[model samples]
Target: MKSIYILTLLSFFVIVINLSSCDQSIDNLYTEKSRIQFKYFKEDTVTQGQATVYRRTYFDRTTLSFGMSDDEVQEDTAKIVVEFLGDVSNKDRTYRVRINPDSTTAKEGVHYKPFSSTQTFRAGRRKDTLSIVVLRKDLGTSFINPVDYRLTLDMEATEDFNLGMKDGLYTHLYMNNYLVKPKWWDGVGSLMFYHPKKWKILISFNEKWANKEKEPFNFNNGGREYFEALRNYLEREPTFDDETGARIYIDRLVEQNN
Candidate 1:
């Protein structure tokens, strides 16, 4: 019985050793590689935007509040993480990053704060993150001109690490603070709701109203009450019956979301 117990303990030790070795091998697989690039599926959080539209290569547009009070507006930060292709290194590695704006329309300091020109990936680590803070006050436009600002991030490899992919070496972000006319919007001002209900109302509207443009409508800034009322109204009347005269009584029935 003692011999059997000893044999079982030995087998467990062997299994643990094998598992540890496997984990080390897997870590080395990436650490030993000469490549480093952007990590995929990482999300960016925006406090003032409704949606982030990603295009073929990079981000297409980051929607911003059209008109909201100071309390409603929050600063947005984009955390971009880059990963090393190989196993953890003994020595710390540092890479250079360039944050270049496409035009002078959104000047630094006036429109947004400037980001550091370099980011370091500490030694023995597979990934490093760079944070780009977007100031809420900078995302505004004057009545004379309205335009979106484009910010691009370019990553360069050091002697220790090679640039992983050509396509992912650079990424772009657009900031648009102006009120956007939803493609689905009729000439008349209409309400847009959050998901699920928005989809249901849109489908119903398409079948009945036959409006060709079906893009999700934009909520008026500071229209949280308006948004809730529109959502509730859609829940009750997906068909948007003219007889109910929702347009006439919407403002009285709604309260602010905040």
Candidate 2:
């Protein structure tokens, strides 16, 4: 009995040792080399005029426009989020993003203000958002000949963040100042909902509506992100309907959407 008890204890000790070693291996994996990764947004908070695009080389992308807005909006901006991983330092760390010229065509200071040096990640912080300023003044007078300028940014490897993602490290910006209806607005929204003045104001609330994809909105439900804003705009602007000349009755849709 004494011999059997001793053998059992020895087996239990070996099992615990193996478990400890396995746990250590997992801990090592949990400790990643510190790095920052860029993402357009974490979730559906993108009601701010951006859409996700799926392609062969998957990367974060968003668009900026001074389109449809009044001349008062000569400038617009886009935001990119950065997330920190690994050890949190007691001191602030600095990082920068540089335009990847191979993928960029937008001229700095003309289309966008140049980025200043060294955006900081305060000590013990895990996330930050960077803004890119876009200018609409130089976008020329041809509403018919719409133009899109591209700006792609890359993360700079720094001492605090040597690790980087193999993919999804790029944020591509598609910017334009075309006041014309985007290629998508023909036939559908144009039949009843189409008036150049109305369309211009509508596009300001959500620019993606002008994008070339068919987006169905359910006023009865909560699909429209800028519903209140649109409703208010329509109420204030009394554009008469050509047929009956009644002010475009949005109250019917408002009743349903409400």
Candidate 1, overall lDDT? 0.56
- Looking at model 1, report the run of 10 residues with the lowest lDDT sum: 240-249
lDDT of 2 at 179: 50
- Report the lDDT tens digits of candidate 1 across residue range 47-126: 54777664433542333333222335656665666775666878877777766545334566655578767667787787
Candidate 2 clashing pairs?
Answer: none
User: After superposing candidate 2, which stretches have Cα over 4 Å from the reference?
Assistant: 1-18, 30-33, 40-59, 87-90, 140-143, 179-198, 201-258
Model 2 scores worst on lDDT over the 10 consecutive residues at 249-258
In the range 1-258, model 2's lDDT, one tens digit per residue, is 999999999999999999999999978863755777785444332233486644333447777766556779888877767776677778888777778989988999998888764677778777777788988888654543557889887888776675456554667887886554545445443234434445555566666555545544534643354545666777887655443345554343222221
Q: What is the C-alpha lDDT of each candidate?
A: 0.56, 0.66
Candidate number of the best lDDT:
2
Off by over 4 Å in 1: 1-33, 40-74, 101-105, 141-146, 178-228, 231-258
Model 2: lDDT equals 0.66
RMSD of each: 14.5, 10.4
TM-score of each: 0.46, 0.60
